[model samples]
Target chain A: MAQGGGRVQRAAVIGCGTVGASWAALFLVHGLDVTATDPAEGAEERLRAFVEGARAQLAGFGLTGSGRLRFVPRVPEALDGAEFVQENAPETEALKRALLAEIDRLLPPQVLVASSTSALLRSAIVADCARPERVLVAHPFNPPHLVPLVEIVAGDAATAARAAAFYRGLGRRPVILRREMPGHIANRLASALYREAVNLVAEGVASVADIDAALCHGPGLRWAAMGPHMTYHLGGGAGGIAHYLAHLGPSQERRWASLGNPALTPEVQAAIVAGVAEEAAGLSVAELEARRDRALVGILKARETVAPDPAQDGTAEE
Target chain B: MAQGGGRVQRAAVIGCGTVGASWAALFLVHGLDVTATDPAEGAEERLRAFVEGARAQLAGFGLTGSGRLRFVPRVPEALDGAEFVQENAPETEALKRALLAEIDRLLPPQVLVASSTSALLRSAIVADCARPERVLVAHPFNPPHLVPLVEIVAGDAATAARAAAFYRGLGRRPVILRREMPGHIANRLASALYREAVNLVAEGVASVADIDAALCHGPGLRWAAMGPHMTYHLGGGAGGIAHYLAHLGPSQERRWASLGNPALTPEVQAAIVAGVAEEAAGLSVAELEARRDRALVGILKARETVAPDPAQDGTAEE
Candidate 1:
């Protein structure tokens, strides 16, 4: 199968934990042969198990590819014939730097190396690499095989464009950041929202269950349809965002001023823990995860029916 | 036709703008007689047109009621036989206070009055009313006929509970606030998220369209399935929120500290306006709205298939 201009037929997946396993599944489902490596005990077994589970979900999206997967005990073995590399080691500065340096030394200059680190800087992680220009951050939301978002941060626009095309070819929505921030784009947006959510819980304004319901039922539903900027554009009415900014910008600033900066004190943490337990009712984490995945599958199917024409928006372009 | 223990068979909707018209449509579809009034020119024509459009969407949800709608020129006429009142006047504190006082004077103490004001405090709005305890704020998300969330803020718990029961009877999710706050729960969370969204745009981290896509494709999808708290709970793995809080609290604080506090300056506003225009991709606001409603319908239908049993979580209870 052709992907990224038919240049990436084989891929190396380093550190086969959850993120790596998910990436491997995605690559395999796109018809790219995957050679995955991890140093942990029983890593291959766990990686295979995860991929098998993910394959079921991928099949729901009609993503069936004929690629084989091989597990290796070392990075060099996995990188032997790889055209692309995805690194998902645990987020330790020294460890990631060393691992990336090793991978950089072994691979050719043209092979794109992407990190799945959510907390560390790409510059710091790529410092020890021989060709840091080829190293980039291609962070995916958890369970990468299911979620379509892949945030790309690169040293140059050309490499970023190449990575975006590759991910887009594999049926992912890749957002390329012009510059790197602490949590990329989505996580930062999510953290901002969650901070206010936590503040509400701490202030005793509402229970955990009610707050969750308010979001999923209200703005959350709209968000699944469009982003904040576009939502406000509609909120602006016929005049659009310009009108909204002219009329409602002051009120937004007022709300922002009153936004809380709550500390995650012990009491607040306890309150949240108890609230989540109550919200979860009697369901275990596994049960909740299953529920979430089921709902996600349903939503993805629903979105497919009404997805915008990507051609008009340059969403599908290289 | 019973609502609020069969005490609210008839509802009076004052100020028939977009919010009021949506409320009127929701009430009518819930099998309540609706008497609506507005002083704006051609208000009746616009309200009827809006309701006609909403009725088609409500029918998709199987909410076909045998209620009747009446348009009255004066508030007293509308309130004459009203068992409940939903006020959607302009969000000026003085105007809302005066309107509530008039509504209070015309109605008996037992009849409940709910305001749809997104801004302004419940106490401030109900201050001039003779029976202030009976008045509360029941703020609905946009297009109240479609979205399910109705945030209720009252001076007392009994009033909030009563309002919640009424809304739940109408097939809406009602989150009752223990105390009133600016922007309520959903809007506050939205603003918190949007602030970062704006910050990203201002900082030139990514394009407006990509930022939006990142959200809807990533966290937004998860949000539709569950709230932020629940998302993080799942993120915590088997150990849950407690484990997450203990381990990830510092990183969260660091991100929060680094979170942008972007000013909606002239330049920032211009950049956002241009970005939204680009994101819309030549689509008009009305077209975007239709797209949003269509996607929302699809999502709601999909959610129905996997909706949790509300009985277990007390989600359907008063």
Candidate 2:
């Protein structure tokens, strides 16, 4: 993963909404010229604001690199001479097919197109392309400037490797999806948790505020470092994940039986909003996000040193 | 929310495993007297290491508060003079029931006993206890030091208020589960995601590294800050969750219909493990955890300032 202008030189972000804007910012901050586009009338302004927000966040990370960005009025303009095209168009399947087809026809054959769909499959998403092999899913987290994960699901196995190299060029940790599943991996897990939380609150067993609190405080914390299987590995001492699973497998199975999402009902919906509302009792979304980003900045800065070696520092033990 | 000595000043932890040690360390770091008991002979050494690990984490957060911690030989001894007892015993109902019985016999009526059970229900686990009112589930994350969430499911709703305050006092975000379910909130969601990841790989759709990579790069990034519902909320702009749901609900449901986590067969298990192992490359479990925690520490520190606020940061969009 060479940091300098190695393989990926310039990038194209073919949308300017939450996901697209984030992708563009990451590319620009990593020193790649970004050409972002959207059909919306106010996309330029939104893109600019979005870029500023992302830059604010990247600057917090110390702006280790630099690049330029331009917002064009048209799609072809945005895709101008780009080596890679990241599509953050609407989630509609038809829209993606049409968009990919257009990019495929216009952009050079060597340019790869990445989709930022949360739920759609890469094969399903790229089925219509003449060069579908070059199109894959390069889905990133919302506000990619802060969070560290970028999932690269190959439309085909070959595309997966190419996507990995591209994301690596941007200094992002790209986890590949061997197989495609709805909601990919994390979202499905999150949705499951959320559904149950709603169910609990809906059933009057607890409040929405409480359910979120449980996760944000409990597993959410541990998960910030390791997944449940890996955590259990440590929980099992030398027994490792397999041993922990073997011992706790029955319990895990029993637990899994009861894991389902809560039905979204009127009362339940009200409760959830109110509960989360209370949890966010004093801060606005922007304020919370600001606070979140600020803390994230400090966290990432600290991580630059302490994070790469948690065990030696006793940071990983308990 | 007042940071003062007038708050509760005592805590107790039983079964000093990773979770228990984290609980004890946190309780002590927050200026509470924590008495920890474990039948394991190496408990002291482990506890010291765990405490030190937690202390370093707490120190990073600038929490200068201190609390007393003593290793008691017996469960009752650990519970003695403790206002709150965090039960981190193994995830066994039988073991928990037996321990609760003994704890009920010794602890006064007012003392709260919170079990750190990952997926167990409070009622079933506390069924054998005579004074079940004082016993509830206050499950924390694996390395409780880094994460700030605490799921406080009141066994009978009797301990709800106290559990909330106690956890909040420890600088944790406490979520209440209106009802008991497997994996609480985060794990349930997590399982949903992991299950699908497993299913996909088992079916030969993709590889393990690719699946993990997809998540790490995609939804995992968003989840690290704003979760799915909220992410969708923003996606919908001012429309909020209801608006987003109204429009995308069917599609989301369509995605949900295909989300499956089948029983792990021998073949599936081998494939899943092999996939993850290949993903692991050459890193050991401990090494992986250390890397995870260190990275998490940085992420968390950066996000610390992004505290959830509701007043000025209106969350109606969620």
Interface RMSD of each: 1.8, 3.7
RMSD of each: 2.4, 6.0
Considering chain A alone, report the TM-score of candidate 1 relative to the true chain A.
0.95
Can you write out model 2's per-residue Cα lDDT over A131-170, one digit (the tens) per residue? 8877888777656766666676775765676676666656
Model 1, residue B174: displacement in angstroms? 0.7
Q: What lDDT score is found at residue B160 in candidate 2?
A: 74
Q: Give stretches of model 1 more than 4 Å off.
A: A1-4, A304-318, B1-4, B304-318
Compose the digit string of candidate 1's lDDT tens values, residues A1-318.
123445578999999987999999999988989999999999999999999988888898898996799999999999998988999999999999999999999988888999999988898999999899989999999778888899999999888878887788788888989999889999999999999999999999999888988899999988988999989998998999999999999999999989999999999999999988988888899888878888888888886322353453433334
What is the interface root-mean-square deviation of candidate 2? 3.7
Q: Which candidate leads the pack in lDDT?
A: 1
- TM-scores of chain B alone in all candidate structures, in the order given: 0.95, 0.90
| Tens-place lDDT digits, model 1, residues B138-221 | 999987887889999998888787788788778788888989998999999999999999999999999988899889999998
